[model samples]
Target: MKIKTCLIQDSPVFFDKDKTLDKVEQLTKKYAQQGCELIVFPESFIPGYPRGFSFGATIGSRTDEGRKLYSEFYKNSIDIESDDIKKLEKLSRSEQVYLVIGVTEKQQVNGSLYCSMLYISPSNGLLGVHRKIKPTGTERIVWGEADGESLVTFHTEIGKLGGLICWENLMPLARMAMYKKGVEIYIAPTADSRKEWTATMQHIALEGRCFVLGCNQFFTKSMYPEKYRSLVADQPENMCPGGSVIVSPMGKIIAGPLFGEAGALVAELNLEEIGLSKLDFDVIGHYARNDIFDFNVAKQPEMVKENPTPKR
Candidate 1:
C-alpha cells in the first residue's frame, strides 16, 4: 500500500487552546482537500510549548507567579475526553484522513498534565495515545510521568502506526520495542529544531528500515516572553525554526526541511521500500548475534531486580 503523509509545520498558539484548535481545524481541512492520507503535527500543538520561560514569570521571579502561569496554561490544556477531541474526531472522519497530532493533555481528576500524542482514525474513532515517557529537563516541573502501560502501537488501516515523543526517540530500548512490533511508519513529533535534528531522523529511518515522518514546530523568539528572548538573542535564527522532514527507508529526504513556515510537507511513500531496505541489515534477522551479545529488556519490577545491572 502507498501512504501519503503530510507534516504540519506551524507556530503553535502561544498558551491558547481555543486558537490552537482553530488553526488545527483550518490546516486539517487544507491537507484533506489535497488528498493527504495522514497528517502529522508537532509536539504540544495545543496551548503551545512553554518556549523557555515560566508561564507567569513576569508577575514575580519567585513567589506564586510561576505557579500561577503554570496553572493558567494547564487550564488551557485539552482533556482527553473533552469536546475538542470529539470535534477533532469528527474532522478526521469527515476528511477521511488519519491524524497523528500532539497536544497538552490535562487529567480531569488530579489536574496533572501530560504531553500526549493522539491518533485519530478516519472513521471518527479514538485509535490510541502515547504520552512522552519522560519530559525533557525543565518540562518535568509542569508535566507528570506517563504510565508504563501506555506503550502501544495502533493497528490502523494505513499501516502499523507507532511513535515516540521528542527525546524519547533517543531511547534505544524504546526504538527497539517499536522495531520488534514491525512498525512500518514511525511518527516522531518533536520540539527540537536544530539543524542536526533532521540528521537524527534520517539515521533512525535507516536504522529501523522504516519511513520516518518527523514533524517539528516553526517557532520564533516572539513566541516567548521578552525575558526569555534576551537569553538566546545571539542565535535568534534557530530559536525554534521548523526543520520538519520525512525520510524514506533508505534514509533519503522525501518531503522537506520546511524551515521558517507554518505549513505542511506532503510526501508519497512506496511501502515496498521497507522490505527493500531491510534485506541487508535487519536488526532481528541475520545481522543479529544471539550468542555473543544478547540484549534483554524486562518491564516487570521482579524481573528487573533479578537481572544483573550492566556496568557504565
Candidate 2:
C-alpha cells in the first residue's frame, strides 16, 4: 500500500489550548487538501511545550507565582474528554485523513497531566491514545506517568500506526513490543530537536524495518506570551529548532530534516518495502532466538509495575 503522510513542524499557539487547536484544524485541512492520508504533530503541541520556563519552581520551593503559572498551564491543557478532542475527531472525519497529534492531556481526576498522543481515524473517529509511560528529567514534575494501557497500535486504512513520545523511543523492549504488534508507521512526537534525534529515527526505521515519522515543533522565545518572554529572553535563536523527519523502511530520509524551520514535511511511502526488508532481518520472525531471550509485555502495566525486571 502507498500512503501520503505529513509531519507538522509548526509552532503552537503557546499557552492557549483553544488557539492551538484552531491552528491544528487549519493545518489539517491544508494538508488534507494537499492529499495527506495521515498527519502528525510534535509533543505537547496542543497547548505548548513549556520549554525553558521553570515557573519559579525549585526542588523544595514552589512559589505562589509558580503555582499561578502552573494553574495557567493546567487551564490551557486539553482534557481527553474535552470538546477539543471532539473537534479533532470531527476534523479527521471531515478532512478524510488520519490524525495523530501530541497534547498535554489533562486527566479528569484532580487535573493531573500526561504527555499524550491521539490516534484518530477518519472512519473510526477517536481510535485510542498513547500516554507517555514515563516523563524525562524535569518533565516528571508536571506530567504523570501512565500504565501500559496507553502503549497502543491502531489499525487504519493506510497501515498499522503507533507511537511513543520523545525518549521512550530509547526503550528497547517498548520498540520490540510495537514491532511485535506489526507497527508499519511508527510515529514519534518529541520535544527534542537536536540533530542526533534524526539519527535515532533512522536507527529505529532500520531496527524495526518500519517507516518512521518523527515530528517536532519549531519554537522561539517570541512564540511565548509577552509577559513570559523575559523568562526565555536568555535563550538562543530557534529554541526548539525542528528536525521533524520521515525515514523509509531502508532507513533513508525521504522527506526532511526540516531543522530550524516550521512547515509540513510530506512524503509518499511504499509499505511493500517493510515486507521486503523484513525478509533480511525480521526482529521477531526469522531473526529471533526466543530460547535465549524470554520477554514479556504486560497487558496492564500495573500488573507488572512492581515486577521491575526490565520489561515494557
Candidate 3:
C-alpha cells in the first residue's frame, strides 16, 4: 500500500493556543484536500516551541518574572481532554486523515506539562498519546518524564506507527523498542534543525527498515510575541530553520529537508519497501542476536525490577 503523507514546517502563533489551533485547522484542510492521508505537524506546533526563552533557573535561584512566563506558557498548553484536542480529533474525522502532531500536554491534577505526540485516526476519535519518555537537555526543566506506559506503537491501516521525540532518537534502546514493536512508519517530530539531524533520520529508517518522517518548525525570533521578543533578542533572527524530511526504508531521501521556510513536504510512501529493505537487514529479526544480548524496555514496571537496582 502507498500512503500519501505531508510534513508541515511552520511556526505556530506563539503563546496563543486558539490562534495556533486555527492555523492547524487551516493547514490540515489544505493538505487533506491534496489527498494526504497522514499529515504531521512540527514539534510543539500547537502553541509553539520555546526556542530562546529560559524559564529563569540558576543552580540555586529562580526569578519571579520567569515564573510568570512559565505560568503563561502553562496556560497555553493543551489538556488531552480539552476541546482543543477534540477539535483536532473532529478535524481528523471530517477530513478522513490520520493526524500526528506534537503538543505541550498539561496534566489535569498537577500543573506539570509534557512534550507529547498525539495520534488521531479518522475512524477513531482519538488514538493515544506518546509523551517524550525523557525530555532532552533544558527541556527537562519544563516537561516531566513519561513512564513506560507511553512508549507505545499503534497498529494502523497504513502500518505500525511509532517514534521518539527530537534527541530521544539518539537513544539506541528507545529505537530498538520501536523496532521491536514492528514500527513501519517512524514519525519523528523534532526541534533539532541542524543539518546533521537528517543523517539521524536516515539512519533510523535504515536501522529499523521503516519509513521515517521527521518534522520541525521553521521559526524566527520575531515570531514570538513582541513582549517576549526580548527573551530571544540576543539570538539570531532565525531560531530554527525547519529540517523536516521523509526517508524511505532503504535510507533514500524521498521528500525533503525543508529549511528556512514555512510550508509542507508531501510524498507518497510505498509500504512494500519496508519488507524489501528488511530482507537484508532487519535489526529485530535476522540482524539481531537476542540470544547473546539481553535488552529490555520499561514497558512494564516489573520489567525494570528485573535488573538489580544499585544502592544510592
Candidate 4:
C-alpha cells in the first residue's frame, strides 16, 4: 500500500479553546486536500502542551493561581462526547482520512484530566482513545495515569495504528508492547523537541522495523499569552522548535525533520517496508522466545492501583 501520511508540526491557539478547534478543522481540510490518508498531530495539540511552566506546583504545594489555571485547563479539556470531539469526528468523515490527535481529556467520573490520543477513522467516526498510561515528571501533578487498556493498537484498513506520548516511547516495555501488537506505523506525539529525541525515534524505527512518525509543536514567544510569555521568556526564540519527521522501516529519513516551522510534513509510506524489514528481524515472530519472556498485563487494561481517580 502506497499511502500518504502527514505529521502536523504547528502551534496551538494557546489555551484559546475555540481557536484550537477551528485550527483542527482547517488543518484537517488542508491535509485532506493534499491527499494525505492519515494525519498525526503533536501531543496535547488541542489546548496546547502546557510546557515551560510548572503551573505553580512543588512538593505537596500548589499556589492559588495554579489551582485556578488547573480549573481553566479542565474546562478546556475535550469532553469525549462534546462538540469538540463531534466537530473533529465530522471533519474526519468529510475529509476521508484517519486522524490521531492528542488531547487533554476531562473525565466524567470526577472531572480529572488525562493526556490522551483520540483515534478517528474516516469510516468509523471515533474509534477509541489511548490515554497516556503514565504522565511524565510535573505532568503527574496535572494529568491522571491511564488504565492499561488505553495502551492499545487499533487495526485499520490502512495499517495497524497506534501512538505514544513523549517519554512513553522511551519505555522499553511500552515499546515492546506496541511491537507485540504488530504496530506497523508507529505514531509518536510528543512535546520533547530536543535533538536527542530524534535519535530515539530513529532507534525505534530500526528496533521495530516500522515507520516512525514523530510530531512536535512549533512555536515562539509570541504564540503564547503575554502573561505566559514570561514563563518561557528564557527559552530560545524557538521555544518548541519542531522535530517532526518520518523514518522508514529501514530507519532512513523518508521526509521532514522540520524545525522552527509550522506545517504538515508529508511522506509516502509503503506497506512493503514492513514485510521487507521483518524478514531480517521480526521481534514478535520468528525472533521471539515467548517461552522465556512474558508480559504481566491484565486480560484487559485495568485502572492503575497506585494512582486512584481524583476526588471531586
Candidate 5:
C-alpha cells in the first residue's frame, strides 16, 4: 500500500495551551483535506516546548513563579485519556487518517509530566504512547523520567509505526531496539534544528532501512518571553528553523527541509522501496553479524531504599 504522510512544521504558542490546540486543529484539518493519511507534528506541540528554560537553565532559576507557570502548563497538558485527546481520536476516525502527535503528557498518579508521542489510528483508536526514555539535560528538572514499559512499535494499517522524541534519536540502544522491532516508518518529532541533526536522520534512514519523517518547528526569539531574549540573541534568523523533512528508505530527501515557516511537507511512500533499499545494508537482515561483534546493553538495576521514621 502507498502511504501518504504530511509533516506539519509550525510554531506552537509559547506556554499557551488553548491557542496551541486551536492551531493544531486548524492545521490537522487542512492536512486532512489534502487527502493525507498520516500527519506528524513537532515535539511538545501542545502548550509549546519549554524551549529556553528546559534547554539551558539551572533548577534554581525555576523560581516559585516559574514553577507555578510550569505547574499551570502541566495542568494544561493533556492526559492520555483526556477529552482533548479523545477529540483528536474522533478526528482521526472522522477524517479517516492516522495521526502521530507529540505532546507534554501528564501522568495521572504522581502528576509528573513527560515528553510523549501519541499514535492514534483512523480505524483502531489510540494505538500507542511512547515517552522519551531520557529527557535531555535540564529537561529532567521539568519533566519526569519515563518507565521501561514505553519502548514499542505500533502495528498500523499503513506500516509499522514507531518513534522517539528529540535527542533520544542519538541514543544507540534506543534506535537498535526500534530497529529490532522492525519499524518500517519511523516518525522523529524533534526540537533540534541544527544542520547536523538532518544528517543524523538521513543516516538512520539508510542504516535502519526505514523511512524517516523528521519534523521540527519554527520559532523566533519574539515567540519566547522578553526575559529570555538575550539567550537567543546570537542565532536570530533560524531560532527553531522549520527543517521538517521526510527521507526515503534509501536516505534520499523525498519531501523537505521546509524551513523558516509553518507548513506541511507531503510525501508518497511506497513500501516496495524498503525491499530494494534493504538489498545492500539491512541492519538486522543480511548486513548484521551477531556472533562476530556482539555488544551487550546494560539495564539499570532497581534501587531499594529503606523508609526512615521521623524524630518526635
Candidate 6:
C-alpha cells in the first residue's frame, strides 16, 4: 500500500495553547485537502520547544523569575483529558487523516509535565500516546520521565505506526522495542535540526528497514514573547531551524530536509519498499541471533521475576 504523508515544519504560537491549536486545525485542513492520509508535526509543536530557555536554574538554586516562567509554561500545557486534545481528536475524525503531533502534556494530579506524542486516527478518535521515556539533559527540569506504560505502538490500516520523541530516538533499546512490534513507518518528531540529525534518520531507516519521517519546528528567537525576549537575547535569530525530512526503507532520501522556513514536506511512501528492503537484512528475523544475544525489555517488575538470571 502506498500512502501520502506530510511533515509540517512550522513554529507554534509560543506559550499559547489556543493559538497553537488553531494553527493545528488550519494546517490539518489545508493538508488533508491535498489528499494527505497522514500528517505529522514537530516536537513541542503545541506551545513551542523552549529551545534556549533556562527557566532560571543554577546548580544550587532556581530563582523566583524562573519559577514564574515555569508556571506560565505549565499553565499553557494541556492534559490528556483536556478539551484542547478533544478538539484535535475531532479534527482528525473530520479530516479523515492519521494525525501524529507532539505536545507538552501535563499530569493533572501531580503537576508533572511530559513531552508526549499523540496518535490520532480518523475512525478511532484518539488512539494512544507515547511519552518520552527519558528527557535529555536539562529537559529533566521541565519534563518528567515516563514509565513503560507509555512505550507503545499503534497498528493502523495504513501501516504499523510508532516512534520516539526528540532524543529518545537515540535509545537503542527503545528502537528495538518498536522494531520488535513491527513498526513500518517510524515517525521521529524532534527538536534537533543539526545536519547530522538527518543521518540518524537514514540510519534508522536502513537499520529497521522502515520508512522514516523526521519533523522539527522552524522557530526564530523573535517568536518568543516580548516579555521574554530578553531571556533569549544572546541566542541566534534562527532558533530551531527546521530540518524535517523523509527517508525510504533502503536509506534513500525521499523528501526534504527543510530549513530556514516554515512549510510542509509531502511525499508518497510505498509500503512495499519495506519488505523489499528487508529481503537481505531483517533485524528482527534473519539477522537476529537470539541464541547468541538474549535481550529482553523489562517493562514491569513482574516480568523480571518471571525470568531471573543466576546471581553471583
Ranking by lDDT: 6, 3, 2, 4, 5, 1
- Pick the winner on lDDT between candidates 1 and 6: 6
lDDT tens digits, residues 1-312, model 5? Answer: 798899988888777777887787788888889989999989998877766654334644645656666777787797887788788888888887888888999989887899999888776677778888899987887788675567767666688888688899998888887787778999999999887888889988998999999999888778886765665566564578878889988999998887778778998999889988887888987888987867443442222121222346
**Can you tell me which runs of candidate 2 are displaced by over 4 Å?**
300-312
Worst 10 residues of 2 by lDDT: 300-309
Q: What tens digits encode model 3's per-residue C-alpha lDDT throughout 1-312?
A: 999999999989998999999999999999999999999998888778898778897778889988998888899998998898789989998998999999998998988999999988887656788899899888887899898888877787767888888988999988888888888999999999999999999999999999999999999887888999888889999999999999999999998889999899999999988888877898988889888988777762211111222347
**How many pairs in model 6 have backbone atoms within 3 A of each other, for residues 3 or more apart or on separate chains, i.e. clashes?**
0
Off by over 4 Å in 3: 300-312
lDDT (Cα, tens digit) per residue for candidate 6, span 84-158: 878998999899898999999988889999999998888777778888999999999999999877777877878
lDDT of 2 by residue, 1-312 (tens): 899999999999999888888999999999999999999989999899999877787888888887888888899988878788789989998998989899998887767889999888776677788899999998887889988787888666688888699999999988887887778899999998899999999999999999999999999887788999888878885699899999998899998999877888999999999999987898888888887988778772321111111334
Number of the top-ranking candidate, with lDDT as the measure: 6
Which of the two candidates, 2 or 5, achieves a greater TM-score against the reference?
2
**lDDT (Cα, 0-100) at 153 in candidate 2:** 81
Query: What overall lDDT goes with each candidate model?
Result: 0.80, 0.87, 0.88, 0.85, 0.81, 0.89
Clash totals, every prediction = 0, 0, 0, 1, 0, 0
TM-scores for all candidates: the values are 0.87, 0.94, 0.95, 0.93, 0.88, 0.95
The predicted structure with the larger TM-score, 1 or 4, is: 4
* Candidate 6 global lDDT: 0.89
Better of 2 and 6 by lDDT: 6
On residues 97-122, what C-alpha lDDT tens digit does candidate 4 reach at each position?
Answer: 88999888899878799999988887
Clashing pairs in 6: none
Model 6: CA > 4 A from native: 300-312
- Those runs of model 5 whose alpha carbons end farther than 4 Å from true positions after fitting are 54-62, 225-238, 293-312
